[model samples]
Target chain A: MLAQGLTITISVLIASAFFGYLFAFIAGLCRLSKNVILRKFTGFYVEIFRGTSLIVQLFWLYYAVPMLFGIELGSNWWVGVIAIALNYGAYMSEIVRGSILAVAKGQTEAATALNMSRFQRMRLVIFPQAVRMMLPEFGNYLIQMLKATSLVSLIGMHDILYYGDILRSSNLSQAPTVYLLVLVFYFILALPLIFLTRKMEDISKKGVASQ
Target chain B: MIEPIVTFNDVHKSFGDVKVLKGIDLDIKPAEKVAIIGPSGSGKTTIIRMLMTLEQPTSGDIIVDGKNLWKMEKKGSMVDANEKHLRNVRGDIGMVFQHFNLFPHMTILENCMTAPIHVKNEDKSTAKQRSIEMLEKVGLGDKLDNYPSQLSGGQKQRVAMARALVMRPKVMLFDEVTSALDPELVGEVLEVIRDIAKEGEMAMILVTHEMDFALDVADKVLFLDEGVIAEQGTASEVIEHSTNERLQSFLHRFRS
Candidate 1:
């Protein structure tokens, strides 16, 4: 039973992290764009998603939005994924913006003097250097998104915590054992993420050193 | 009677009431080398920056190769040049910075090849061949695969010169190119620049504190003071025999 719950939790974490990364980059670039409309739109999206509660957002998507559209989502899984992606994406956009800005002004001027188009300059020169600065913050956001997935249990998704709750109710005498095992399981899942973050940090540092 | 390669007509620049360049006018003929010398805040670097379109002039025209740089034709009326127009006009010019701002993430060869392949749309093989040749010319042929961080100040500046030359610009601007180098390294970078000037087809504008190098390589020298050309003449006349009080004092500091 715990095995089934762990599978669902891991899947949601992976999917949300991927989608969040994509959204973060798009929103980050939009925020930095010269077009006032795009910049304003991204600003509004980031503030709305980041300012509000994530659980409320999940509830709105799962319960209210589908009803308004007159379509049945049948499961809250999609809503859980979407809410996690958007909320974390909003937070990560600021990280992306800050890292991009931190790149030296001389890099941009050098690209301009070379007569490169704006897009070419960003892709070839600026983004490559900026990504090095973004990696550590991005790793932290990924792990935070993993922990936040436990909130999906409130909407009836059978993630890890949900399974632990079921076990406690089914065998109340073993409630301590069930809860303790669940804690161990969460630790097991989180430890590897932290280890991977360290590994990625080392690799990125080496990459920059070689450069 | 060849046309001047660059023209600055009554150019004025200011930063919120602090005027840096005040009504400056000058012409740079093809294959001519002009050195601009001045005190620290006298706007020597501003002229190079404006020519490269890194900064805009407040009010006047900068014409490069007959096209007004800060202004463009819009429905037959002259209007301010937009980014697109600026990029088009920027193709014939290149600049080397005091800091040798080579892309730190790329190898020297990649740095030299990037602008030519991406901006000029040269084929990969041709760009690579040209880049290798230019790197050799700048005396960095052995260091082509090395990153900018691995190179010394002088080597990095040479790579910068090679990177700009690979684009084959008709006009080059050097903004205190040797200022950031150590005294021992300054000679190698200046030697490379002297070779580029002697090759003699591209118009060059150099802003430098090396008065002797300026005298050796510059065809003409303009002494700028208080945001205007205080004196202008051949290298010997301006550097050695200037009568202006501001220029004489300025050169005296460099002499000792």
Candidate 2:
């Protein structure tokens, strides 16, 4: 049962993070668009998600949204993933936008001097450099987003914390051990990500500094 | 007389309330080498930047090879050129910046080949060959695989020149290309520019502080002051023989 819960938790984390990055790039680019409508619409989205409480958003999507819209989100996990991704993606988009803007003015000027179109300049010159700049911040958000995934268990998603709750209630005497095991599981899950972030930071430093 | 390759007719540029360039007129002929010398705020760099399409002139016309650079004919009337129009007009011109803005993520060879392959649609092998040849010409043939961060300032500047030269531009603009280099490293970068100027294939405009270099490579020299061309003549005539009081005071600082 604990293994099943762990599997479900990992699946939701992966799904949310994937969709989160997709939404981030889209909204970030939209915010920088020349069209007023696109910029305004994306700005509204970022504000709506960023201003609200994460748990309230998850609850609204899982419970209130179905009643209001008369639409089924299909699974409890789907609602949890959607809410978390939307909220986190809003925050990450700012990271994306800031990183892209931080690229040196001289780089863009050089691209223009080479006769590159706007699209080519962004794709070939600007984005490649910006991605390296984004990695350390993205890694921070990844860890925070991982811890936030435990909130899904409150909505009956059967995540690790949910199973831990069940075990603690049945054997009150083992509650401390059960909670300790739960803490260990989370730390174990986070270890690889921490390692990966460090590796990325090192590579980025080498990319920027002298060999 | 040879036709002028580029003509600036009454060009004016302003940044907000401050006028940077005031009613400038200039011409660059094919295969001509011109150097512009000026103090920090005299708008020498802005002139080359406007010609490169990095900055737009507020008022006036820039004609490149008989085509308007900042204006395009729309339904038989002149209108501000769009990005496509500006890109098309500026395709024949290339510029090297003061900072030698080579792409950090790419190896030097990739930097040289990227514009040719993407913008010009050259085949990979052909682009690679041409890039290698250009790198060799700049004396960086062995460092093709090195990234910009790995190279010294002089080497990076050479790579930048190779990147600009690979496009086979008809006009090359160098905007104080040695300004950021270490004093010891400046000579190497200047040596490469001198070699290119010797070939005399494309017209070159150099905005520089090196008066001696200006005399060596440029056939014509313009001294800009107060957002206007204060004097213009052959390099020696302007540098050694000019008696304008303002110009003499400017040259005195460089002499010591």
Q: Which candidate number would show the highest lDDT if scored against the true structure?
A: 2
Tens-digit per-residue lDDT, A1-211, candidate 1: 7767998789889989999999999999899999999999999999999999998888888889878998866567778888999999999999888878877888888899999999898998889888887787888888899888999999998999999999999999999999888878877898988988887687556323211
- How many collisions between residues are there in candidate 1? 0
User: In candidate 2, how many Å is residue A128 off?
Assistant: 0.7
| Window of ten residues with lowest summed lDDT in model 1 chain B | B241-250
Model 1 over residues B1-117: C-alpha lDDT tens digits? Answer: 889999999999998999999999999999999999999999999999999999999999999999899899899998889989999999999999998888887899999999898
lDDT of 2 by residue, A82-103 (tens): 9889999999999889878888
All predictions: root-mean-square deviation over Cα? 2.2, 1.5
Docking class of 2: medium
Sequence-dependent TM-score of model 2: 0.98
Q: What TM-score does chain A reach in every model?
A: 0.92, 0.96
